[model samples]
Target chain A: MITFYEDALCENCYAVRLLLHMLAVPYTSHFIELYPSRANLQPRFRAINPLAELPVIDDDGVIIAGAAPILVYLAAKHAPGTWYATDTPALAQVTHFLTLAERLSATVGAARRHESGFAPTDLPAAHTGATRLLRGLDAHLWFAEQQGNAWLLPTPHPTIADLACFPHVILCEEGGISRQPYPALRRWCDRVKRLPNFLVMPGVFLTAPPKTE
Target chain B: MPDPTTANLWHPIAACADTPVGTPQRTTLLDTPITYTLHGEGHATAASSSMLPVLIRYGYIWTSLGTPTADLFDIPEYAEPDRRRFNAASVSVHVSAPRAVENFLDMSHFPFVHTGILGAEPHTEVKEYDVETSAERDEVLATRCRFFQPQPSTAADQGAEVEYVYRVPHPNCAILYKSSVIDETRRDVIGIFVQPVSQERVRAHMLVCVLDDRSDDETIKRFQQTVFGQDKPILENQFPKRLPLDPRAESPVRADRVSIAYRRWLSAKGITYGVIPAA
Candidate 1:
C-alpha cells in the first residue's frame, strides 16, 4: 500500500499515477490543489517535502519526494526486473533518461503550467526549450524504431524512464507544443498508451488501438 | 557580397556511408538547401542555384556555401594502424551551431547533466584546467582537465579517472581527446562537426577515432549514440537558441574557461550567423 500525493492536472503527478496503475499497486490518493488557494503550501504537505513538490509517495512509511525519485523507488521495490532492471549498466542507462525526464519537467512542464495559467515563467524560453527537447526525443525514437528497440532503453521492457518522460510529452499540446512534426514520437506515445494498466489524465487521451488484419 | 563566415568555411553535410552511389542526399548548409549525388568513380555532382566545392574525407561529405579559404583540419591519428575510426549517425538539433559547439566544449555538465555514466553527483567539482589558442593552427585548446567516470568507454568494466583535452578548430567543429581505458599510453579522439542549417538549427556529425581493440564497431557506435542522446535534450532546451557573444551575457565560472575562449574566438572572427551580438 502507498499514499500518493497527486493532482489531476499536474504532469509530474500523472507520471506517478500512471506507473502505479501499470504495476497494479493499490494506493490511496491525497489530492493537492496546485492553484487557487494553494493547498500544497499547507503544513501537512510541507512536512512531507520542504520544497512542496508534487508526485510524492509514501510506500508504507518510506516517504519519497519528487516524481523521478518516487518512480525509481517504486519500480525498484515493487516490480524489480520487470519495470526496472537491476543490472548496473542498465540502471545507469535508465538514470540517463530519468535525468532527461527531469529536464522535460523543467522545460515542457513549465511551459504547460504557464499556458494553463497555473504558474508564471518565461513563456517564450520554455516553448523554445520544449520544442528542442521534442525534436531530440523524436530523433531518438526514430532511430530506436529503426534498431527494433521500442522503449527508451534498448530492452524489450518499459522502464521507469519511459514512464517518467511520457506524461509531459503527451500533454505538451496544452502548452502549445505540437506533436504533428514528430512522427516517431507520436507513434511511440501510442505504444506507451497501449501498455497494460495504462491510465489517462485530463489532457491525455487513450491512443487508438492498432487495426488487426 | 557573400557572407565570409558562410563562404570561407567547410561544413560536413552528410556521412559518406549515408550517401551511397547513385543516390541523391539532401541537406542544408548555412541556410541553403542543396542536393548532391556520389557517383561510382568517386565524384559528386550538385544541382543548386550556385556552384560549391565538395570534398570527401574522414568518412564525411564536406561542402561550403561560399568560397573556402583553407582545407579541412587534419587528424594525424586517422593514418595510425592501431586506430579505428567510426562515423556515427548525424543528430539534428534545434539550437544554433555555436551553441552546439560550445556545449561540446563544456565538461562541467557531465555530473549534473549526464549523471551516473559520465560523472556522479559526489564528484561534481571540475578541477582547474589550462586554456589557450594556438596561433599556428588558429584553434582553441583546453588541457589538464580530469574527471572520474564509471564507464569511460563502451569497453570499460570499471571506473577510472579520465584525462581530457578539447579543441575547437573551427567555429562549428570541436574535438575531444580523452585517455583510453584499454591503452595506457594512447587516447581516444572524438570530433563533433556541426552544420548550421539555419540561424537556429544545426546538424551534428560525430566521428570517433579510438585505439581501443576491446569493443566492436557496432558497440562503439551505439555507445557514442547513447551518450549523444543524453546531450540532445539539454542542448535543445537551453535558453537563447543563438549563443550570446558578450562575455557579460551569461555568468561564467572557473569551469567555463573553454566555453569562454570559444565564444571569444567566435566574436573576434566577426562570425554572426548563429550568435546574438554582444549588447
Candidate 2:
C-alpha cells in the first residue's frame, strides 16, 4: 500500500490525491498540518525528505519526493498508457506541462499561502506571474476546444498534465486570481470535474453531471 | 457622493443553519468583524463589543454595522409555504459586492461562463429587455428578459427558452425570478445577497425559493454551487475588482440593458461603496 504524506490544502498534494483516486489506487494517508505550526518543516519529516516539501509518498517503503516525480512514478507503474503517455513526443509534452505545473505551484501556490498567512511573499508579483500563466493556459485551451480536444494534450483522455494543473486553477481565487476572463479554462475545469472517479477536496467542488439519456 | 451612512444598510452575514444556538459565529460585514448567536432569536456583537442590529430573514442572518436607514427589503416568495426554501452554500469571492450583484443581473455571459448548464454557444444573443427604476420602491427592475438555457434549474432535464425578471432592491443584493420547470405558471426565485467584507472582498449568500418537490436540498445546493462556481473565478478575474459605475469605464452592449440600468441606478443613488465612483 502507498503511504501518502500530504496536507489537505496543499495544491501539490492535491495533484497526487487526484491521481490516486482517479486510478482507484488504494493508499493510506499521513496527514501533515501545514498552518499555524508547520509540521512538514519538523526534523522528523526532514529525515524523510531534506527539502521538507509536501507530497512525499512512500510506496511500500520506497520513498518518493516531489509531486511531478511521484505522478510519473505512479502512472508508469499503474496506468501508463492512459495517464503518462510513454511515446516520444507525448512524453515531451507531458514533461512540458509538468514544468508549467511547477510554475503554477510557485506563483499561485505562493499567493494562496501568503493569503492564508502560511507564508509571506510579494503578493503582487505572484499575481502577475500567475496571470501570465493563466492567460497562456486559457489561450491554449481555447485553441484546443476549437479542435474538439478537451484535455491539456491532444489525447483522447486526460493526461497527468490536466491533473497536475487542475488544483491550482480551481483554487486560484483564494490567491486573488480570477478565472472569469478565461472561458476556455473554466470549461476545461468542468470537463475535468466530470471525469470518472473524480475526487473533490475541501476547496475543489463538483460540477453538474453531464447530460445522460 | 455615497451616503455617509452607507454602512447602515443591512447585509446578510450568515445562513440561518450556520449560526447554531449558543455557538458564536464570527463573520464580517462591511469590513467590520461581527459575532452572532442564535438562541431562538438572533443577536450579534461587533468586534468593538457593541450590540449590532440583526434581522433574520430570507433564510439568512442579516446584520448592520450601524442603524439601517430603511427596513430590510421584502422577498415575499420566501414566505411561500409550498416552496422548497433553502440557503445555497455561501461563497467568498475576491470581487467587490457591487460587481457580484452586477454579474447576477447579467445573462450575456451565461453562454460563455456557464456553457452547457445555463446557456450554450450558437444561442448567444440576449434579446432586448425592458428595464426601469421603480421610483416608489427605489429598486431596479428588468422585465420580459428571455434566454435559451440547457438546464434552467436542478429540476430541469432539457433545454428551454427561459423567461426572467431581475430586481436590484439593494446595492449589493440582486434577485432573479426565472421560469420554473415544475410550475411553468410560477417563477422560481434566486437571490444573491452580498456582504461587503472589504473594498474587494465579498461573501455572497444565495437564497433559493422554488416550487420543486422532485429534488431535495443537496441536489438543489449542488446545482447552485456549480453555477456560482463558474461565476466566482470570472468575478475575481474582472479588472479593477470593483464595479465601475462610470459609463465610460467599461464598454457595454445592447444585451447589457439591465446592467446599464443597474449602474445608472447606483450612480443616481450615489452608491460609491464597492464601486468606482463616476468622475
Candidate 3:
C-alpha cells in the first residue's frame, strides 16, 4: 500500500495519482490545500516532505518526494514492465520527458497558477515558454506517430513519460495555453486517457474510447 | 452577388491532425462561436449559432460563417506524391485578421522581426518585386521576390538565397511559395490561414508542403513554429490591432508593394470585418 500525498487541483500531484490508479495499486491519499491556506506548509505535512512540495508518496517505510520521482519509484517497484521499462534506452527517454514534465509544471503549470490566483508568475513569459514547449512536444509526437509509435518513447507500451506530460498539457487551457494548436499532443492525451484504469481529477475529463469496426 | 468577404471565403479554423476522433473542438470565427467534431466515416462537422459549411482540405478543417461563394483554394502540390506535408500549430495573436494578413505579406520585417534565421541585419534591402491582380483567379499575386536567410528551412543547415512568390486567393488567406533547400526546381508551399476571432484578435494556421524528403514532419513543424513564434510577439505588440486600409494611414515603401496590393484588394472587396476604414 502507498500513502499518496496530493492535491486535487495540482497537476503535479495529478500525474502521480494517474500512475497509481492505472497501476491499480492500493493507496490512501492525503489531500493538501495548495492555496488560500497552504496546508502543505503545516508542520505535520512538512515532516513527511521537508520541501513542502507535492506529491510525495510514502511506500511503507520509504518516502519519495515530487511527482516524477514518485512515478519512477512506484512504477519500478510495482508495474515495472508495463508502466516503467527496465531497459536503459527506454529508461533514458522516460527520464528525459520526466524532466520536461517538470519544466511544464514551471511554465504551463505556472501560467495556470497565475491565472487561477494560486501563485504569482510572469504571465507573458510563462505563456510564451509554455507555447514554445507545446509546439516542440507536438512536433515530437507528430514524428513519433509517423514512425508508428503512440506514446512519447519508441516503446510499444505507454510509459511514465506519457503520464508525466499528460496532465499539464491537457489542462493547459486553464492557463490560457490552448492545446488546439497541438493536434498530435491532443491525440496523445486521448490515448493516455483511454488506458485501462485511467482516472480523472478535477479540470481533467475522460475522452471517448476509441471506436471499433 | 454575395459579399465576397463574408459569403465566399473559407477560413481554416483547425487542423485535421488537431481534431481527433470523438472530441469536439471549439473556436470563434468572425465573433461567432463554432463547435467542430469528427464523426462517422471521418467526416468533420462544424456548427455555430447556426449551420456552417465545413470542408477538410490539405490537412485543415475549413468553415465559413456565411454561405461560401466558392470552394476552398486549390493546391495541386497536395496531390503530389513526392512532397511532404506538415500542419504546424496555430498561433493566436492579439491583432486583427487584416493586420495579420498584411504582416504575412510584408517581407521587410524578416530582418527586424525574424532576424538571424529569416534575415540578417546587413541584408535589409528589399529589391523590386512585381505585384498584379490575377483577374482569372480573382487573386493577388506577387512574384520575382528574393531574399537571403540564415536558415531557410529545417533541411537547410546553411544560409541560402530564397526565391519567393506570394499569393492571396481570399481576403483572409495568404500562401507563399519559396525555393526549397533540397530541390531548387521544386519550391516549398506554405499557406497562412487566418481566422478572425473578433475585431481585435486572430489565429493563424500554417500549412507547409515541401518536396524535400530529407527531414521528418517534426523538423519541418519546428522550423515553421520557430519562425512564427518569433513573429507572434511583434504582431501582438503592434500599435493598431485592426489594419488600416488607407494608404495615407501608414507610410508605404517599395518593400510594401505586396501589402499595398493586399490592402487595395481588401478595400475593393469591402472587407470591413477586421479593417479600419479610411478616414
Candidate 4:
C-alpha cells in the first residue's frame, strides 16, 4: 500500500494515477488543494516534499516525488508486463521520453498554470515550446503508425514513455495549444485512453473503444 | 462585435454541472466575459453591469446578448421517462460556433476522424440523404442519411448500417437523431449546442438522450466524449477558422447536401458574425 499526495486536476498527478490504476495498486489518497490557498506550499507538506509539488508518493517509508520518477519507480516495482522497458535501446528511449516529460511540464503545464492565473508565466513562450514538442511527437507517431507501431517507442507494449507524454499532450488545449493539427497524435491519445484501467481527470477526456472485430 | 442576428438568439454559456451552486464561474460568450453565480436552484445572477439575460434549460445555462424573439428549440425525446439524458463537459475549440455546428452535420469525416468506432476505411461512403429547409419552423433538416459504422454506440455489440437525421435549429446548434440499438423504433438524440466565444473560438456543449438499458451514465458519456474528442482537433484545424457562407467558398460533393443547405440557410438569415461573407 502507498500514500499518494495529489491535486485532483494536476496533469502530472493524473499520469501517476493512470499507472497506479493500470497496475491495480491500492493506495490512500491525500488530497492537496493547490489553488486559492496554495495548500501544497504549506510547511506541513514542505516537510514531506521540499519541492512542494504534487504527485508525491510514500511507498512504505520511502518517498518518491515528481511524475516521471514515480512512474518509473511504480512500473519497475508493480508492472509484471512491459510498462518500463529493460532492453538497452528501449530503455534509452524510455529515459529520453521521461526527460522530455519535464519539458512538457515546463511548457504546457506552465501555460495551464498561467491560464488559471496560478502564476505569472510567459504564455507565448510556453505555447511555442509546446507546439514544437507536439509537432515532433505527432510526426513521430504518424511514422510509427505507418510502420504498424502504436506506442511511443517501437515496442509491442506501451512503455512509460506513452504515459509520460499523454497527460501533457492531451491537456495541452487548456494551455491554448490545439491537438487538431496532429491527427496521428490524437489517435495515439485514443489508443492510450483505451488502455485497460486508463484513468481520467477533470480536464482529461475519454476516447471510444476500438472495434471488436 | 458579435453579429446582431446571432447575438439576438440564445446560446448556452455553460453546462449547469460545471457551475456548482454558490460558486461563481467565468466564461466568455459572443466575445464578452460572462460571470454568473448560482445562489438558489434555477436562479442565476451575473456579476457585471453589462450582464446578459440568463435562462436555464436542457441542463445548460443559456444567455443572450440581445433581445431573443424565440424560445430555445425543443427536443421532444428529452422528456421521455425511460431515456437517459446526460451532459458532457463543455469542450473549447479554436474554431467558430458555426464551424462546430457544420462539422456536427458532416458524416464524411467519421471514417478518418473517428476511425474504428463511428466508421472505418473501405466503408467510407455516405449514402444519399434528402435535405430540406422548413420555412414554417425556420430549420434545416436532412433525413434518410445512412453510414456504415464499426461500433455505432457504446451499447452496440457489432457493426451496423446506422440511420441518421440531422437538424440545424439554430445558427450555432445542431441536433442528431440516430437509430437506437436497444429500441429500433426510437432514435437517440445527440446535440451540439455551441457558444461563440469569439469570431474564431467556441465552447461546444454536448447533449445526449439515449434509450439504452445496458450502459451506465459514465459509459454513455465516455462514448459521446470519445466521438467529440476526435472531432475537436479537426474542428480546430479548419482553415479560415470562421465558416464561409459563400456557396463557392469551399467545394462540396453530393454528400454535403446538409452542410450546403445549412450554409445557404445561414446566409439567408443574415448571420454574419462567425462567417466569411460571399464574394
Best by lDDT: 2
Highest TM-score scorer = 4
TM-score of chain A of 2: 0.98
Per-residue accuracy of model 4 over A1-213 as CA lDDT, tens digit each? 799998666789889989999989999877775643356888999999999998899999899999999999999897735998877888889999998888988998899766543565888899999889889989999999999999899989998889998999888876777889999999999999999898766556567688898
* lDDT per residue as tens, model 2, B34-53: 87777665454434368877
Assess the local accuracy of residue B101 in candidate 4 as a C-alpha lDDT between 0 and 100. 91
Tens-place lDDT per residue, model 4, B214-279, is: 987656665776677567667766899989988888999999999899999999988889899776
* Model 2 DockQ class: incorrect
Question: So what's the TM-score on candidate 3?
Answer: 0.60
The DockQ-derived docking category for candidate 3 is incorrect
Which of the two candidates, 1 or 2, achieves a greater TM-score against the reference? 2
* Range of the 10 consecutive residues with the lowest summed lDDT in candidate 2 chain B: B39-48
Q: Write the per-residue lDDT of candidate 1 for residues A1-213, one digit (tens) a residue.
A: 799887656789888988889988899877765542255788989999889878788888899999888888989888998788899989998898899999898898898776544576898999888889889999999999999999988889999989999988987866668789999988989999999898766545567788889
Q: Model 2, A1-213: lDDT tens per residue?
A: 999988666779989999999999999877665542356778989999999988999988899999999999999899988998989999999999999999998998889877644576899999999999999999999999999999999999899999999998998877877889999999999999999999776557678999999
Error of 1 at A198 (Å): 15
Task: Give the DockQ (2 decimals) of all models.
Answer: 0.03, 0.07, 0.03, 0.11
Candidate closest to the true structure, highest DockQ: 4
lDDT, candidate 1, at B241: 92
Cα lDDT tens digits, model 3, B1-279, are: 224565557888877765556698677787778999876444788998777888888887788877777788788887888888757547666788878888888888888767677898898888999999876898999999999998888788899889999999888888999998888788889889887778887778888888766776645655665577556656766778788998899998889998888988888888777778776
Query: How much DockQ does model 3 earn?
Result: 0.03
Q: Per-residue error at A94 for model 3, in Å?
A: 27
Sorted by DockQ, highest first, which candidate order results? Answer: 4, 2, 1, 3
